[model samples]
Target: MSEKSSDTSGRPESSPESGDGAEAAPGSTPAAVSGAARVSPGRANAAATKPARASTAPVPPQDTGPDVPKVPAYLQTQPRPDVWLGKGPQPPGLLSRLRTPSPPAIGPATLWSVFATALLSALLLGDGLGPNLLIVAVPAALGAFFAARSAGRVLRPWTAVWAVGGMALLAVPALREAGWPVFLAVVSALALGSLALHGSRSWPGVLLGSLGLFPSVAGGVRWGWRGVRDRAGDSRGRVRTVVRSAAVAAVLLIVFGTLFASADAAFADLLGRLTPDVSVGDSPWRLFLFVLGAAGALAAAYSAAAPVRWDGITVRPGKARNRAEWAVPLIVLDLLFAAFIALQLVVLLGGYDKVREETGLLPAEYARQGFWQLLWATVLTLLVIALALRWAPRGGPRDRTLVRSVLGTLCVLTLVVVASALRRMDLYVDAFGLTRLRISVAAVELWLGVVLVLIIAAGVLGARMLPRAIAASAAIGVLAFGLLSPDGLIAEQNVARYDRDKRIDIEYLESLSADAVPALDTLPEPLRSCALEHFRRDLARQDTPWYASSWGEVRARDILERTPVQNHGSDCYGLGQEADERGGDEEEHSYDPY
Candidate 1:
């Protein structure tokens, strides 16, 4: 048998010398073979059974060099051949790439602004939270705003609105000395302002952007460092000259000032008074505050200028369920809510007597028992509405109508639950004088009612603006809460309760900050002396700087100064004796203002 040839198509070809009494097909192979031809058994079998077509193109010579393995089909599409083969340097990781600084360096003007803000923070914040907080916060916010503007970033109308709101919240510490309100107000202001700066639109985006502030602060530091490094090379000569001049000037001033002070005693006194007394121990703290302020401001400006497009991050909705599947459970829930509301209506009208007869508890006690559960129910209802909306079918008009009807009814029922919760809190407060916890919970319940209303409005109109509206409402609620002064309100309520019932928690009043002083000062003789004593001593001892003096503290001090306590002693109200008699059985309640 003659050797068989193969074609580029990998098919075996018949040879004319093959003595099988079969002639070769016309043009079955090329006229001149390019290489030693060999065919696998499989190809030979196929070629023997099937005829081949004539070749149209000349065959190229095969390589006789050392064989190189071909890349697998999957590997051929790889972006980096060396990487795929585990050869050469591997690329940096996702984190490394993220850490690497990108362009739009901090400009000199912005840097100077950051420096001034930092310096102001170091000087003013050292005293504590007060007008100093407002002073530092305003400039920092303005610096960020202006820096962003200078960098050609657009400032939306809402940006200015949020900025003003944040500044107003920051002023809470300046106006009120209550620790809880000030802390809450300041924290809310920061989080909301961060969202505003980044222009977050959706609820998820707002949450993520608020959290992104920390990383942004860190990135801002790195960004500022890079800007400084890039500019250092260009300004090396000028920096060196400036440093040398500063050092020489410092030495000359020290030497001549000492000589002049020695020559004149009055000059020495004046110099001593003028010079700042900064201890080495305090320098690090001051430096920390400065860096913190600078980092925060720079982060805000950086975020405002080149905001991460958090709103652009699309969250895939859950697969839409059939209208019946989505709406059925919600409808059932609404029915349950409606039944509960109907029962609540009975109680609201006059059935409290029946409840008391069955439970052997007063109306207030009954209200108190279910208040927390009702609050949680309202919260969970809102959550359910959110989830239902997420998974509701996006079919034709009918599906949408179903969604609106079911969810809107549920929301309306939830508003009644919120009202019940607030009414419960009111009854409890009326029965036993208002405490911070009672008032705070009442405020939260009221805000929940407001949210339900907003949700209803969204369902009526469109849900596109609902998230922003909800967020704005929350900000407004917090602002109103802080501005109203929860501590002051608590004191006023207790005082009024005392006027009505001739009973008050003097011990609790004593624990309140200066925010309650004005209210507490209105009490009668010994009670006034008892309630005002703590603040009187506190304000007298607090030698705060002018910048750090809060309006509450200032007013308290003025009031106490003008009307000094007639009776002052640790046992002014026999509170210790009362506590001893009670065996210290008072329940200590800790509340989270958030």
Candidate 2:
């Protein structure tokens, strides 16, 4: 072969007939020879000797045309090993995830269940909450259950328990007339039920799942629309045919029915009564209720069918600190708590007389003075303990012993504070009869005591289940509070206080809901009549439909019906006229001392 001519840059120039100064092999082209020249001799010999192994490394695309510029190495995209192995693409960002395709279609039974729930909600909830809430909630829960089953998901025992709890909460509006308890119970029930359905075991997971409800509802709507869109193509002809048939039937019925009604006055009257007054004004509200019900039901079913693995979320442990750094502050806190507990003990033991003399406050006033402060202090102590545990030294036995000793002491002392706060509430209640705020706060303080106890117990038993235990305790507390009927209990306590001191606030009694009727009706004569007057007037003027009738209202009406107000003409102890003149601004005489 002739030597190739050298160019000005000292590189070998190509020949017209053959490239790279070499004759093309029998079956190979000049491009092949050039490519071969680019390979190293060692790699070529190795490739010739060994069988080719597939590479996970990405191959750059071949140049398609001479006009195309070569891409830089850094700019070229490379497939990851996972992608090359067909595992799937890497996780995308939030916006990318949101833009992903809709989930697969739900089962026909689940779809119909959603529709039925929506219809029932529109019919029952249009008037407001009552036994009708229970009616709607039961079918919605059952739909979730069946959806889970059909999707091959196993329902944990806790799921059923939470579902039942939610149903009981839904029945609160039907059982109790107090709006606050009903609202709180309903919200707690939804959170608990959502957590249970999603199988969230961690405290953070529970929080995230509860917060995810709105997103889940939106997803449900999207899923429903996608399913409808997918089935529309197949069902279009059938739908059109049905619509035409219905239109024809409606027109024929209208003509013949009108003629028959004109022929008979009784038939016309019956027809008019049977036909519902479907006004345009009410249509929007009914539609809103329907959509709300359908969306909620669909979300529950979708979540149960393919629950997210909220429990799988891992939280990074906080960086460990020196044993002294973690222990010193907690030890100081424990000492402070101890000092407070000692003070409480002294007061409990006979120092009350000295305190009363020095403070110049009545027993109730002294009790109320520091109750809120102690409650907050107890709450802050729990927070300190949690933080201390998080950063506690992960060293040897000495570190663990120090952590347990300091944190356990704090918890014990905080329990004393909780007790003090509760004692103060009790004294205050005795001084000024029980009110909703007092009872509610007292219940919270009681729950805090229980939590402190749980924390102490967790020191002995591993604290793996502490978060869930605390959540369950709170849920159970709320359910029990709702079931106990705080208004009725407040009424009873106030009535008992009146019997003891012969001093009652009739105005306060009148402000209570219908749930307190039975308790208030036990009062003697004019007092009973005055207390029941408001409830009696309300019940008499009210015309609640059966769907919106609560058991609390029914019971109150029955009590008032059996025992009419004896002294209607009496000025309700002169409080009624004052209330009207003040425009219900009787806050100055309110029983809530706090």
Where model 1 places Cα greater than 4 Å from the true spot, the runs are 1-103, 236-277, 349-360, 568-594
By summed lDDT, which 10 consecutive residues of candidate 1 come out lowest?
585-594
Per-residue alpha-carbon lDDT of candidate 2 for residues 1-594, written as tens digits (9 for 90 to 100)? 123212222332333333222335488775655554343344334444445454455444434467767899999999657645776667875423422243347766677688889988887787656777888877777777777787777867766666667777777788887888888888987887787667766767667765445557777777777766776777898668866998999999999999999999999988865543346789998899899999999888777776765665677778999977778877887787778778777555444465577567665777778888987887887787777777889889888888888888788888888877887777678767798888988999999999999999989787887877787788889888888999999999988877775556787778888999999999987678888888988888876665577788889988988878876575676653443344322432334535
TM per candidate comes to 0.76, 0.76
Local error of candidate 1 at residue 410 (angstroms): 0.8
lDDT score for candidate 1 against the true structure: 0.74
TM-score of 1: 0.76
Count of clashes, each model: 0, 0
lDDT of each: 0.74, 0.74
